[model samples]
Target: MSIQPVSRERHAHLRWKGFSSFAFAASTTLAPLAAAEISQAALALPLAFIERDGHWSMAAVLGLMPGQNLYVDAGGVWLGRYIPAALRGYPFLIGARADSEPPPCIDASSGLVTPGEGEPFFDEAGSLSPTVTQVMRFLEQTAQSEATLVDACETLASFAVLEA
Candidate 1:
């Protein structure tokens, strides 16, 4: 998959179509959760703290093993009331860079980015459209919350309240 940063200069011509299925997340066993959504997500999904490269974050446990997600059915539909923020934003992601804040990116291969179709990322004036603006804001907020989530999880681990 070609994952590239989104910018008015590069992605201005691209259009974004909404995710049609949870198929993209069908193989994911753990979906990252922000601190704000932890309570709601835990109501329906088993919550667990996951560690990557020694960084901790809370996540929703979707299955017992890797490449399996019990919440997503054979049809790629998610059978849950609260979709994790990570999975909710399909094709769009916040990418981390050295000494910089995360940038919003797109999974170009997800078939969600198209030319002359769906909602435009930018308007004719080369500015973010309303739809893209809302999505970008949500992604940025989620990224910001990730730090708090990590701190909280680390605190939980320190208290011997969480298991990776």
Candidate 2:
């Protein structure tokens, strides 16, 4: 994916047609779960604790093998009743930038993006559109909550309360 930070200066003309399929996420074997949505996701997915560099994060196990997602069907549809928050925010991500709150980014190569014929990123007033603003807000909230969950998981690991 050609991920690039979104900015009015760079992508004012770009528009998002939105995606109709979950196929874009089919390559992943795990999907990160936001704390707020974990209960719902757990009802439909097996929860797994992923460890990296001694830090822990919770995710939904999508498949047993690498590069495979069992929840997404061959037709590009999601089979689960509760989708992970990380997968819901498709083509958009909160990119980390040093010490600052990360900026929202988009996959410019995601076919959903276009110069015309979709939801515009910026309005004629040169401000972010309401839709874009809402998406940004959701992405920020998801990232913040997931970070908290990761910290909690790391603490649990440190105390030996969580099993590998």
Candidate 3:
């Protein structure tokens, strides 16, 4: 997915309209299934712990092939207790910049972004609107949580607990 940095200077007028359907249009599977809290995932979707390339992770099996998601219906409605945070934070993502800390970016292909529609990204005073701020916070928290999960996985691997 092509992601561009979200900037007031570049996207001062762009607004993010709500998504009309499930945003996992690019993948059939969601992996590394760690969230801010992993227990919350168990209450919703079934998870499979897997080891790949010497690293262990979890995944939620969504479907059997590309373009098919069992959790979403034909009308693009989600039919699960919890949507994956990775998917929920779609269009908006944390990506590393060339010379600065990672910044929140927007997927250009996502139809939610428009010039004159939906919720305003920035207020009249050139500040982020509540929606944008919330998204940014979510991305930041998700990144930190994912890092913790990775560290935990690595610790387990160090103990020879994960099978390759």
* Number of the top TM-score candidate: 2
Location of the lowest summed lDDT over 10 successive residues in candidate 2: 48-57
Expressed as tens digits, the lDDT of each residue in 30-56 for candidate 2 is 888778888888788999899865679
lDDT scores in order: 0.85, 0.87, 0.75
lDDT of 1: 0.85
Better of 2 and 3 by lDDT: 2
Q: With candidate 2 superimposed using the best TM-score fit, by how many Å does residue 146's alpha carbon deviate from the native?
A: 0.4
Give residue 75's lDDT in candidate 1 (0 to 100): 93
lDDT of 1 by residue, 54-145 (tens): 97787899989999999899998889888999877778887779898777788988988888789988889887788877887898888778
Off by over 4 Å in 2: none
- Extract clashing residue pairs from model 3: none
- Descending-TM-score candidate ranking: 2, 1, 3
**How do the predictions measure up, each by TM-score?**
0.90, 0.94, 0.85
Q: Residue 99's C-alpha lDDT in candidate 3? A: 98
